[model samples]
Target: MNTTRTVRLGLPILLLAATAGLVAAPAAEARSLPTYTCGYTLDQPQFDSVRGRECTASAGAPLIGHHWITFQMRNSGSGETWVCNSVEAALVPYYLDNKIDPDYADFERAYGRGADASVCHRLLD
Candidate 1:
């Protein structure tokens, strides 16, 4: 051990193993769920009849208190079956009133094709 005292004790053990590998390196993933852009507002004369459908979901930001906003619907002749509704993200343009769906004349002809949205984050307590 003569090379300058082994290079000052291996340079402090190589800087403490490079700071313990950057503090165990592992942390980057926290976004429960939020990001939507649905569509479905067949302007049947703007809104006077024809089932007066409406479902233009949207959620780009603002939704961090347990999060909430899931508007889904699909009943074009009962394609299996799917109908959901949950708005709370400050409620921004979330309308899904397919004429109250009494099958509303098959959802007023083509009023139900696809209009999904999502932004939910409430993991326990």
Candidate 2:
């Protein structure tokens, strides 16, 4: 009789423990953010490619649908200050509030204006 009762209690405890572990696994092993790059342009008739899309983690703005981003170009000309803007279509959403990876933040902070769409992580609500 005692053995039967003990087994009932033990099974429930084991099941509860298993459930807790299962719930925590995904949160612990969540996927990390991939790298992204944005483009930079110069003030010229033919917009020359000064730099390739560089990685960044600037996830401040809330992106709805496909977000469009315009980054002002920093002039590299000889003492000539000029600003040029380039717009990226369908910018990817890259940050979440609940969890942030300490090792690295999302691309919004890292790449600033030099990030492109290749490395965007869709956040879970």
Candidate 3:
């Protein structure tokens, strides 16, 4: 075949091969992390009136012995909020009815007024 015709035909085949390789390339897999939940009970009626109070966290794999985590509490009302941390886990709860971006973190909801806890942590695996 003439040089011009060969070049034109080869260019399309080259482009097609490149496109096919990209389409067939494996996608990057997403990493899955462990999740932990902290439970809370409203014992005081004065603090129980607030609606939508929750406690949550994204816990990481323990390093040396401690798992680096962020705890948050949000209360929309004028209620009370508390953080309870123990050797096993960390818990934040809305008492009077009282809430990051982390691969693994927790949250707590609040009531009455608005309350927010902002905390960030960097974890090295």
lDDT of each: 0.36, 0.37, 0.36
Candidate 3 positional error at 55, Å: 11
Runs of candidate 2 exceeding 4 Å displacement:
26-125
In terms of lDDT, the best-performing candidate is: 2
What TM-score does prediction 1 earn?
A: 0.26
lDDT of 2 by residue, 38-101 (tens): 3442333344322223323233422222234433222223322222233232233434353455
Residue-pair clash count for candidate 2: 18
User: In each prediction, how many residue pairs overlap at the backbone (N, C-alpha, C within less than 3 A)?
Assistant: 0, 18, 35
* C-alpha lDDT (0 to 100) for residue 46 of candidate 1: 33
Task: Tell me how far the alpha carbon of residue 122 in candidate 2 is from the true structure, in angstroms, after superposition.
Answer: 13
Distance from true location, Cα of 34 in model 3, Å:
4.1
Quote the RMSD, in angstroms, for model 2.
17.0
Stretches off by above 4 angstroms in model 1 are 1-3, 19-26, 35-114, 117-125
lDDT by residue (1-125, candidate 1, tens digit) is: 69999999999999999999999899798643332233332213332211112332234433212234443332233222222233323222333453464554333323432232233221221
What are the runs in model 3 whose C-alpha is more than 4 Å off?
A: 39-125
